[model samples]
Target chain A: MSTGPYNYSYIFKYIIIGDMGVGKSCLLHQFTEKKFMADCPHTIGVEFGTRIIEVSGQKIKLQIWDTAGQERFRAVTRSYYRGAAGALMVYDITRRSTYNHLSSWLTDTRNLTNPSTVIFLIGNKCDLEGQRDVTYEEASKFAEENGLLFVEASAKTGDNVEEAFLETAKKIYQSIQDGRLDLNAAESGVQHKPSQPGRNNLSNDQQANKDNCAC
Target chain B: MACLWSNSNEVLIQIPLTEEIDNVTFYQISVKVGEIKWNVKHRYSEFYNLHNQLITDHGVSKDILPSKKVIGNKSEPFIENRRKALEKYVQKIFIFLRQTMPKIFVDFLDFHLYDIYFLLQDLSLLCFTKGDLILSSSRVYSFKPIELYAINEFLKSPAPNFTNSSKQLDLGPILDLCSQLDAFIIHGCYNDYLKSNIILNKLPIDLSPFKIQKGLYLSNVSLDMVTSLGNARETVTTLEVVFSNVKRISDILQCDILHKNTLEESQKWKVLETLDLSNNNLMDIDESINLAKNLKHLILDNNYISTVSDLTQLPNLENLSIENNLITVCNDLHRKIGNIKTLNLSLNNIVTGKGFYKLYSLETLNLSSNKITNIEELECLGRLPCLEYLVLNGNNVSSSIDYRVKVLEFFGERAADIYLDNEKPSEAELDKVSILSALRIVKEGKTPDLSMNGSS
Candidate 1:
């Protein structure tokens, strides 16, 4: 029995959220397809995409859900926040309103999702330098104050887009390396893999997976 | 910061009844057990009827039940005393029910009588799998048809068939609806029992790759392949290719290294996206890679590719990693890689930066361990409008006097922003660099002019 390609060690669920036109869907598209969709339509409820990435010599599959940014859409999008391993809080650099709405979004994310959810703040549309309204300093400060990973990215030019996604995965992988995130927690957004012949001891969740299997 | 569900060992204590009329005295109670709060109100006759039913059916005691006082029944103190007594009585009944009738009593406590019925008339228009669903509970007691539909369809249904004749239903939309109601119940109303628990435990059934195998094997396959599957489905695109020592580039392109008959194979390297031709004896690729038009990332690390002759043929090429190559001079790398964003030319013998002059869209450039001597060599990179990140470590220019300042000056405004060695220059560092570079530039220019004047 060949295990085939569905053999990822862990599945990390991610939710991308922000104000309208902040490039939440565009970031997901660029990371997954490596192409900029200029005329990409706005997401209504939630859009799903998956990309397999390698971090610290470990392959992680990212199940990313790009959510709608409209104010009314939060009712539908809030549910997607729970159990997320990573939450990419996107905001348009060209619009101060989007950046201003960061606290409310953070509040919803903090309230609904588990504490282990890696909250990554993204200043999108970095390529639109001429129309830039939000500075890197302020965004970084807000992220630091709120205890979030921060990066300025461009979905169009694909600048720091991969890093935004990969860095989150790297942090999540580091959490797995450290025992900070409990794999046994149902909403921890992490699944421990069973040990095999060539399995390494780096991942300490082998015993956890074995015990879960007994359930 | 707790997870969605907390292990606070919560139990519904005193449910105060609120409201009163002719024969029915009302009780309004707020039962809070940790984060979960249930605000319930019931009339006197309702409790009386339940007490009567319990006595008739289960032969339970009426001693714990608060007796209805006849004197000063409408007075404030009398009503207050009755409310307290009723709360204690309800708590005793719930405690008794916890040991005797757990499921039925819990189910009974979850329902409210003043039901708000909403129309599911737009059910046909709602596309669940398409994820076009939008449901909000912020309207303040406004009816949410989607939440009502979810409760009616999935949670309230006897046995829900979350699938069609062929494929199973996608649980994303359902979960979205469930969590919305759950959040509303927690923060907003606290009256309606958000039937999210049923969906929470049941939705994972659809995600089980092994058809509801309770102990689904995790990490059964290579983590590498799992990610590969995410990018390229087994039936569609090719994700990775690892082959070595090709006499001709066409040998690997024809899939001869992996499979024998290339022509017979319908998917003959057409879907091949990631081509890792590392540790090979390849000198140059001359436009034959046009077969894989969809190739986005091409890795030629540890090869003898002295010059990437014609990578421009692959229109979709965005990433080209040719590290550890023998390229002495990169003349037209930008010409061939018009769309290339990340170029890893580490450990190469590149002396000049003449090749990167036309790379206007380059964001990340890695030219580490090269023979770049002068800062003027990196001046060509200034033309790159989108160059936000660069790594020139191990180069002679890196150790030159005021290297960071010179680099920052060369890139101008972006110097302070770009990440060098995986770190953005701090605000203080940027300020210092700008000041130092200004002094250095003025000093160098003024000395050169004075020396010319003295010589004249």
Candidate 2:
């Protein structure tokens, strides 16, 4: 375990949201654990995961929360929208109903999260190419109109999952560098830590736990 | 006769020092012989010399006035009256402008007096009333020709007070304007300082507690501030009350108290079939089960509920989700009341197969992310005749495809469509005698053949 109280220079809180069965948990699991969870259960209320990744030689720990995608769960998941540094709004490529509900989900995200919170739109389950319902062009257009970052990834194949998390972190780090995201604000969701020895091991244990429950 | 005429005209020649020189040059005036003399240098030749110098300096070649052409034939009396009325209107505008202009600009205005003549020509076409003038001066701080028609129309109406018109006025026009602008009609008082006076509460009866039309939002409101809903309760069906910190259901249930003496009181509570109380601080399910009689969809996802006992009383409940609770045993779900179509027990502490035997009418069962290892535990769900979709995504069911198929085939013909991984059953697994028998049972709506199927 890392002896230092804080292992990373910054902590960024992320939220994964989308329609039901859209692979929100799968995307989070793939990025944090670097493998697919075949029997990963559907999310209930909100699931927690953390991973330490280095960006520009600065250790950054991402504390991600994956929420239930059902419409009814929106009432409880809406509270998690506040204070998010990065939001991963996902939809299944195979499901049209999930794609259709993006606007309402976007409205909730925009209303609840702070202005500086970066929202990224993800189209999950791209591995199931046969069951595709929503086209990429339409989803991209929707993302463009709403000023959100977008990508299509497969959690089963572990494709572009790392890029989604890394891109969000990079965007947030850019905001911090440009002074758009204030590090001192209590709800900015970014924390700066001093460098210390053996702190990387503590993050490893956290990562191991995340890998064990990467669904 | 010249002396008498000069003595009378002296009273009419009242020009300031600045205008006197321009008057002498432009009109070629002769001095009054009987007027009192002063030491001021007053020379007629000097005035002509100044005029000649000004003409040279301004590059004016011709010493002639511009022609004043009539717009139409002036022989008719109507045309003559129209021209005369137009001239008088122009003169009145000049008088008003002269009265309002700064003292320093009086000389400038006098030098360029012809410009005011054209401005008055345009002003003659517009109609003005007292209300129009007041509204224009109040709103447009600066004078402009753009608002003339709007101000004229506003003035022609009997009631001109736009802000206070809602009290004595019909809401038809206001609603039309809101619709045209695509703006929401907020009825109650907003607590924010910036938005304090933006929305008015002038209706005879308060519509605060009333559910606004669909896709409308009403937040941060208490139940007591509302009086009556009129017909809004029956019209607007979908209601969303989020982030209002509404911990108790009593705030919305106050409608029951208000209609205590009414005959059709219970119908009010039954109107709301979809209740969303997900993020509240509810420890038990008693309040929701008692109040929500006609509720078909109940979402208790993130509450601290430990058991499924509170849900057995709901007669019409179809979709029930107690996802993130302290439930461990599947037996707790066996006592469910209605034929629950979907049961979400995804993130619970259930480790054994004892609890899966209880839910009989379940179509979709989520037992993913639990601590269950073997496929034998799910065989208990073979009794569920309606069970079709099963999600075992995060469980430790056997790794081989055949083992997964063997476990799924335990449900016989009514075998629930198992969602284990990215894998579906192969032809060999589907062709197994026990699996075939189970499919026959599913088609016939009979119990699975336990004798032919080997025990786990």
What TM-score, computed on C-alpha atoms, does each candidate reach? Answer: 0.32, 0.34
DockQ of each: 0.01, 0.01
Worst 10 residues of 1 chain B by lDDT: B212-221
Instruction: Report the C-alpha lDDT of model 2 over B1-456, residue by residue, as the tens digit.
Output: 012112323421221232224433222211222432211233334433433543454332333212233453334553344334433432333333332322222222221111222122223322222324433443212222112222222234453222222223232332222222211222233332121111112212244322344322333333343344333344333343333344544444444354433324443444444555454444555543444454556665655666666454444466777676666665545434433567777666677666656444466777667667776677776655446677766666655356666666765533323443434445465567354565667999988533221110
Tens-digit lDDT track for model 2 on A1-215?
11222345677888899888888888887877777888878665566666777776666878787877876556546655655799999999998998999998898888767889999999998989999999999999999999999999999998888888989998998787767888778567676643355444344332342342233
Q: By TM-score, how accurate is candidate 1?
A: 0.32
CA lDDT scores, all candidates in order: 0.61, 0.54
Candidate 2 docking DockQ: 0.01
Error of 1 at A170 (Å): 1.3
Worst 10 residues of 2 chain A by lDDT: A204-213
Looking at model 2, residue B284 earns an lDDT score of 52
Worst 10 residues of 1 chain A by lDDT: A1-10
- Which candidate comes out best when scored by TM-score? 2
